[model samples]
Target: MSASSDRLPLIRLEALPAEVLVDLAAGRQPASLGRRCEEGALPPPEVAGRALRLLASGVAERWSLPYAMIDERGAIVGACGFKGAPCLGLVEIGYGVAPLRRGRGIAAAAVRLLLEEAVIRGGAHRVLARINPDNAASSRVADKLGFVRGEVALDDDGEPLAQWLWPPSTDFAHDGEAP
Candidate 1:
């Protein structure tokens, strides 16, 4: 494994720091960052708190791993990681990079790292994601990660949404191996 993968670069949900948790709960991070981390444009402590609770309860196998794009000085760029249990044969990968970090391929890198973790530590058999059809960048991230169309669901607004899936046996271009 690469040194980056050796450290298991992705932070586990239980390991999130209190300050970072507070920032996430306080709406301090940008919506774009929060969206990638929490799947919404707005920061809602109740929502984050609830998600964290689920993670703690093991109802959700994993949670957001916030990563800085370049270094400590980088803006709270975004978070990427898996959700659900590997033993369940289902692991969903999601991510959001700060708008400022867009076009830099940071989200793709983060997802690749997470997929490696899922394979190495979690024994994940499959991975999944859902994206808004209109978010071209997100769709691209999924595609670059080797995700393919899986299913469609209707949002609360009755808009059609796309679901993407990745087989753990499939090869990832960035990692150069099956996730």
Candidate 2:
């Protein structure tokens, strides 16, 4: 396991090379890096496809922006990161914890660490996360991290989604209001 000072265990996805991503997408773990393929450690097929497309298009500067969430024993428990680099000062963040690791605050810790990185190192002024309305656990993680719940909307596929923003703002009508 790589030594890190943060309380939560995380490794930036950018640290891994393209070959590692290809291996991960193929359900293989880079054992040399001490990575383990727990449930959900690798992105789903669709997400992986998009990542590959982004890589091929040369617009993937932030394609590897995610971090691998690790457990106390150094096994990857999940993944989290910005969808891409900050655009217009806003960055979208996403995370997923293995089913076995749910309810353990792993998502929250990973989000917090990413938030710190975005603001301090990436010059990001805002962070956003879109969650499915039925995803109560994800909502809880956002709430725990002080993300203000915004309007309810539909995603590209017409799925109900709730928009959450971090570093709570007072400008929006939903700001400072409880979800």
Candidate 3:
């Protein structure tokens, strides 16, 4: 890990405007967002579109939707945030970093910030991340952060995903019991 990232690089999540989301969905760097972005700094177009849909559905906002991950130099380096508001005190998180920016602990630190915000400010009691099995890097991040690995389940698109839940101390299995 790069020294900066090792120390949790000075990065912040900035809300992307509608126009910026639109641009990102179209695979364009949004000039309207007004920040220099390293190549591949934005989320994948599909991820951006997902975030846009959440915004359009009136179910998410800057605080709850994906935000542009900005580095100390005021450049966008990636995207990260909750998939939606906490439902039953649980929320899902998604994050990605620029290709050249990986292994620098950017994602880890970004998630840390997001976690603190979710539990402290957003009142989310639990958090989850469904990672693609092939993505070992993300799995490492989850493990490093103490997320417990759960069963692999099919997502909305019928894709197999490994479920990882945070605050590993929680009895997530009990969540399935009859209440």
Candidate 4:
């Protein structure tokens, strides 16, 4: 069922354990969230599976860890985070929203939070949002955040994807961060 949502105050980035990730991936209401899953809050199997791989292969550091996107009402509406800790001062980011939660500025806001976290922790000098060429929505989110285009590269499975880079000096009109 669809739960109440406001575009909203701001989403909290909660660090979840691997077990909880598994639970969310399987469409279960993970106890860590302290609330029931919204209609599309749970991550699909594929997304959660990728996160597991990243966590294991990247030896997730605080800056590169996965996070649950908890809305103001405490329901998780998305999953967002870095692919792994920074390497050579660069890190990749990814985010996904629930079906019912898309088009509400949630992804953009989640991305902003990820960028802020990376900056705050001082673990990454450059943040990259690598997205499939066809993913226009993600491209818009990156653009909204002031990301500039970079060279395209293949992912782990050799799929070519566009790279959007966030320079260290990003201002992004940060008068207020809640989007």
Candidate 5:
């Protein structure tokens, strides 16, 4: 809920009416909603499919929906969110900005907002991000968020990914609580 003045707002998709999803599925942009979704601003096809399946199963609550990253002008410049609800005190976050919006700190801001939400709302003790080793932009976002680089892991596509962890260490204290 706390976004820095320099960062755009992060609107949880779950807070939107179901009709929005319907509209998105139909390729119709809602009027005066946040910024128009950049090409690929919507979740990847696999992620969208998973979301639809979860909705159909009536278990959508068990997963975290994507958040729209809105610029000062109220346009959605990007999206970010957890892949799913916290498990074993950990939540994995993902984010992307419109190609035209890149280099504006939008992704970092969105990730920061997600981290705050994870701590304040999701009670997540740790947040994780997996980035393609070749994606320097994503790596920069993780670095700006104070995420420590971790071991490499293979993504679903069998491509090597660099793992990043926030709050860096389990022993790091927060808000007067032991890590």
Candidate 6:
């Protein structure tokens, strides 16, 4: 079996043990995010600390309700959340799984959970996902969560990418039209 498939039960992030959060932020979680921190792609200490505070602060545009994806043993193996507004009526979702935990369908699960919650609680009319044109994994995650191609846009780094959007309209299930 795959290493991830060999892991145990799944649990919500809010229920994760405190130590796991510490490890996650400290880059000791063996996740891609941890490596991103080590590689300087993520913000440095002071900046990251402030960002985290703002993320958890409950301000719609600045908020990010990050959640940990836990294995049966209560170990956090991935994280996901809504990032910022793509526009007045849209929320953008972002996610990353531990390198060790990839291919387990965890990222897809996280996206689905966050998308559902964002539509319900964040007053979002749509959820946006910007993915690198070459990042098939991320594109797949968004697609599986019901996002459809919106446009092609440049990322913060100015790289071309596919932009996908998911509307919160309940009629999407039956209308087959963009609301």
Evaluate model 2: give its lDDT.
0.69
Question: Which model, 1 or 3, shows the larger TM-score?
Answer: 3
- lDDT of candidate 6 over 101-179, digit per residue (tens): 6766777766666666767665677887777878888887777667776556676678987767785345543453333
lDDT-superior candidate, 1 or 2: 2
After aligning candidate 3 to the native by TM-score, how far in Å is the CA of 16 from where it should be?
A: 1.1
CA lDDT of every candidate: 0.55, 0.69, 0.79, 0.72, 0.68, 0.55
A best-first ranking of the candidates according to their TM-score comes to 3, 2, 5, 4, 1, 6
Candidate 5: list runs displaced more than 4 Å: 6-35, 56-62, 170-179
True-structure lDDT of candidate 5: 0.68
lDDT of 3 by residue, 1-179 (tens): 01244467777887777787788789886778777887777777787788888877887584445777888788888888888888888888999998989998888888888888889888988888889988999999999888887777788899988888888744554442111
Q: Report the lDDT of model 6 for residue 144.
A: 68
Best by TM-score: 3
lDDT of 6 at 112: 65
Cα displacement (angstroms), candidate 1, residue 155, comes to: 4.4
Per-residue lDDT of candidate 5, residues 1-179 (tens digit)? 43655454433332333445555555666554544556556555455445555567664543545666766656667767777777789888888888988887778777877888888777888988889889999998898889877767687789998878887864332222222
Q: After superposition, how far is residue 20 of candidate 4 from its true place, in Å?
A: 0.9
lDDT of 1 by residue, 45-88 (tens): 64456456655676633444333333233233455545445546
Q: Which residue segments of model 2 deviate by more than 4 Å?
A: 1-16, 23-34, 59-63, 173-179
RMSD of 6: 7.4
